[model samples]
Target: MKTAVILLPGLNRDRDMIAAITHISGEPPVTVWQTDTTIPDVDLIIVPGGFSYGDYLRCGAIAARMPFMKALKEKAAQGVKVIGVCNGFQILLEAGLLPGALMRNASLKFVCREVELEVSNASTAFTSGYSQGQIIRCPVAHHDGNYFVDDATLKTLQDDNRIAFRYANGTNPNGSIDNIAGILNAEGNVLGMMPHPENLIEHAHGGVDGRALFESALGLVAA
Candidate 1:
């Protein structure tokens, strides 16, 4: 499957995401710039983590208004798979692609460490590689990663089984609601999460637990 990576100024993890996709898929992903209004035909699009525009206005607030996001929204409407990590997750919420918002870390400080994540919903296209309730290690680095949603929305997420990954093993770095580390859109084509899966997709990163996500999204498996 063809994949594309969205590039924006100040997004430091774009290369990491590109490398992970290449290493796992055996092909380099195409990169799309923030100013570009058109994107190439691809099965998946990834918005990597970083402080775009110096995280001004709020995490991902400035970057979310870019022209590229309009194209992204259009693609999502077509049912193309999209994943946004860290600040990217914030952007997804700002762009209205996903529900809820990311707030300042409950500790009010930046957090960078490995945390365990539970596969809360393994039936989705992005998570079929793992079994439900499986635990995996993933790295997270962010300041405003806390996730919050109203009771009604939270109930809907629970009812629809859209919560993808939750912080497990008592490691709620950002103090996100329900320990939510990642979530899927109502249709299951879009995903937004704070953890950095790209950083842990290889053995050199200490484990290959994160590879299944890409494999699943790329249809390398029966996902």
Candidate 2:
């Protein structure tokens, strides 16, 4: 399976994301620039964490308006599996690929720590390797992670079983509504999450809980 990661100007975690994906998938993913007019057609595309364009004018705002969005949106509409982590999640919301917004943390500070996330819906392509209700450790490093959606929209997300992960242990690090850590789009081909699963895919990182995400995506395409 082919995977690609987009690199945006001023993004700090592109290299880290590259290393993690290489380690987990045994192949380095292709890197594309945010300014590009087109993105490569790949089985999986990841928009990794870190401040894009220094997060100027709101998180993910500048990068969202880049010329590449049209092609990226087209592929997503065609059922390409796309996953966004941290700032990437913010971009997806800003680009209108996903609903809702990520607001500042209730604590109003950048939080960096390993947080527990329960796999709320293991049926999607992104979480198929995870068991339902399984708690996994993943690193969350972000200043804006409080997910916000209207009550009616939240209920629709719940009714459709689109909630992918929720903070475990009653630990609401960002005060996200319903403690949601991740969600899937209506078509289930896209996933957006605050925690960086790519951060914990290596043995030296103190856990391999994130490997399942890569495995599930690759396996599905292989099948």
Candidate 3:
């Protein structure tokens, strides 16, 4: 499957994301710059983590307004799969491509560590490689990973099984609402998550627990 990675100033994780995708799919992804007004045809588009625009305006607030994001929104509307990790997740929410918002960590500090995540909804293209309720290890590094949503929207997400990954095993690093580590859009083609799955997809990262996500997104296995 062809993939693309979004690049912006201050984003430091694009290389890791590109490496993961290339290693898993045996193909390097096209890199899209923030100033670019269009994105090429691709099966998956990833917004990797880092402090975009130096996180000057509430994490991804500034990056969300970039020209590239407009193209991303259009691709999302067309059902192209999109995954945004860490700051990228914040950008997606800021761009209105996904629901809810991510706020500062409950402890009001930066957090970096491994956390367990449960596969809350394994039916989506992003989670089909795992079984519902299955737990996996992933790394997270962010200062504003706390996720929140209103009661009504939370209920809707629950009803629709859109919650993809939840912090499991008492490892709620940022105190996100309902332990939400990841979620899917209404169409299930877009995913926004705080954890850095790209950092954990290889054995050199100590484990390959995060490989299934890319595998699923690329349709490498039968769902």
Question: What lDDT does each candidate get?
Answer: 0.94, 0.88, 0.94
The sequence of per-residue lDDT tens digits that candidate 2 reaches over residues 1-223 is 7888988887777788888778767899998887787778789888888999888888999988998777788889999998889999999989988889999999999999989999999888988899999999998999999999999999999999999999999777899999999998999998999999887887888898888888887774233
Candidate 1: where are CA atoms >4 Å away? Answer: none
Q: Model 3, stretches more than 4 Å misplaced? A: none
Off by over 4 Å in 2: 220-223
Across 1-223, the per-residue lDDT of candidate 1 in tens digits comes to: 9999999999999999999999999999999999999989999999999999999998888999999999999999999999999988999998989999999999999999999999999999999999999999999999999999999999999999999999999999988999999999999999999999899888899898899999999999862
Estimate the overall C-alpha local distance difference test score of candidate 2.
Answer: 0.88
Scored by lDDT, model 1 comes in at 0.94
Return the TM-score for each candidate structure: 0.98, 0.96, 0.99
Give the TM-score ranking, best first.
3, 1, 2
The per-prediction tally of clashing pairs is: 0, 0, 0
RMSD of 3: 0.7
